[model samples]
Target: MSDFFNNKRVWITGASSGIGEALAHAFASQGAHLVLSARNEDALGKVAVKCKELGAGMVSVLRLDLSDHDSIPGIVRNMIASVGKVDILINNGGISQRSLALNTSLDVDKKLMEVNYFGTLAVTKAVLPGMITHQLGHIVTVTSLTGKFGTPYRSAYAASKHALHGFFDSLRAELGDTRIKITLVCPGFIRTNVSINALTGSGDKLGTMDEATDKGMSPERLAYKILAAIERGDEEVYIGGKEVLGVYLKRFFPGYFSRLIRKARVR
Candidate 1:
């Protein structure tokens, strides 16, 4: 339990399950005050209870649907009223995609962008004013390694994640002197239900976890590393096993990386 997170007010979206849920528990154990949000109120409540049991100073459950753009302002307001001021905003909410570029319809791509990119932006913007006023805050976004390298069957998902990198990189530069930090977490894979809930070309759920993800790093371990990165105020951190090697390959061996990605069983 680092003193850096003790009593810190942190808000995490997508806290119902997977990485978000893991993060909620990790931060709680570190003595952070948490505001957890997700579309599933029941699941959120379950997470909140666990947070409480983990010794979170305070835990509030806020039901949120990232796809519903119109509800963002109210959600932000409610969170602010309950938590006072958020010292850390973890934008962990978003959907994944499991469709080929040609098979993915415009509607499907739009939905992916709306949730993964725009939804993250919406929440960050809502919290920025307070952070600016205080002259301090940390924005940690949970992006995928696919953001850095495009994969065969996840074009739309990759695009949305790529947009996040662009947006946050620029934002970090813009806020350079404000003492605010933006950390982009590029996770290769974690054992989660992300694949199962990922949207297909026709808006259908994939409903099956990918094998790589099933054998990937544990979400709990990933959460710990993410918190360490936040504590260090790192610009970005990639968490995973051998999958993280792809980042290096893409940077130093573009041709080989490209061919490897093309043959990857991303689905």
Candidate 2:
């Protein structure tokens, strides 16, 4: 473990499961003070116990609901008051979608944006002032491969992630030499319950796993990469398998990529 994270206070949203739970373990193993938040307080408790067992400096579990944007600031304020200033913030709480644009409802699209884009923005803003005051902070947002390029059945999900790119990119530029660093971590896919929890056209849970997600990289491996990226103070990093190629393919070969994407068997 790098000494860089030994005493750092890291706050992770969606820390109850999947990538979030994996990250909690990684940070704990590095001896960082952790604030883990998710809607599932029960699950968060389980993760907190394991983090403590892994030798976390201190572990605190707080329930968080991303879709409830109005409650974020107060929750963050309480967190800071209880745990001191946050040194690292991992914005990992988000839901995915698995319906085509035509089949997806407006409410579902709004909900995706509500949680993925707006909720994340709210949390970032809530922490921004504190980080600026301390003059020390690193924010790592875990977006998806779809954030860079669109794919079938993920129109809203892609849009929400794309919004993060736009907002954070501009913020990074606007920060202008501030110590506050923004690292956008784009992951192709990491094996998790994301697919099963994904929303369908009617806003109901898909409750089924995608074949690609079933065979994707492990969350532990991605957590390691994310840890390194944060330590290195990277502005942007992409982690995953060959699907990472889709970003460049779309960027440099729009026509060809469009044709290729049409044949993509994405659920």
Candidate 3:
């Protein structure tokens, strides 16, 4: 465990399960004060209990639905009041899409953007004021390899992740010399329930886990690496197996990368 996160006040969204839940446990082990959020209050409470058991200085659970923009302000206010000031904000909440572009409706795309892009932005903005006032903060976003390279049947989800890179990159530049750090984590795949919970074009759950994800990195290991990256103040990190090559290929050999990615079995 890195001493960089010791005693820091951290907030993690989507903490009910999967990567977010794993991260909550890992951070708590390092003695962080945690504010965990998710749509399921019961699950959040369970996570908080585990976090406390893992040695967190303090654990608070707040039920949050990121897609509901109207409720963000109050949630932010409550967090500020309870935590006093957040040292790190992990924008880990978002949904994935598993539908073909042709079959995807505009409404589906809108919903994806609302939760994955706008929702992340909303939460970051809500906490940024306090960070700026204190002159220090860290914003870590969990994007995907799909954000860097396009994949079949995930157009909307990919677009949302790509947008995160653009937004956070600009934000890092804008906050230069302000002690506010932004780290964009692009993970290829992680063994989690993301695929099962992913939304399809018709707004139904995909309900089946993808093979690649089932064999990918474990959330616990990924959480450890992410915390290490944050400690080193890295601007970006790509965590995955060979899938990370796609990023370099796309940059140096766009045509070759495109053809190869098209043939790859992302699902």
| Strongest candidate by lDDT | 2
List of clashing residue pairs for candidate 2: none
lDDT of 3 by residue, 217-246 (tens): 999999989999889999999998888999
Ten consecutive residues with minimal summed lDDT in candidate 3?
1-10
Tens digits of per-residue lDDT, candidate 2, 1-267, equal 568899899999989999999999999999999999989999999999999999899899888899898999999999899888999999999999999899999999999999999999999999999999998899899998888999999999999999999999999998868999999999987899999999999999999999999999999999999999999989888899999988888889999999999999678
User: Which stretches of candidate 2 lie above 4 Å from their native place?
Assistant: none
What TM-score, over all chains together, does every model reach? 0.98, 0.98, 0.98
TM-score of 2: 0.98
Question: How much does each candidate deviate from the true structure in C-alpha RMSD?
Answer: 0.9, 0.8, 0.9
Query: Any runs in candidate 3 off by more than 4 Å, and if so which?
Result: none
Clashes of each: 0, 0, 0
Candidate 3: what lDDT?
A: 0.92
- State each model's CA lDDT, in order: 0.92, 0.94, 0.92
Model 1 score (lDDT): 0.92
Better of 1 and 2 by TM-score: 2
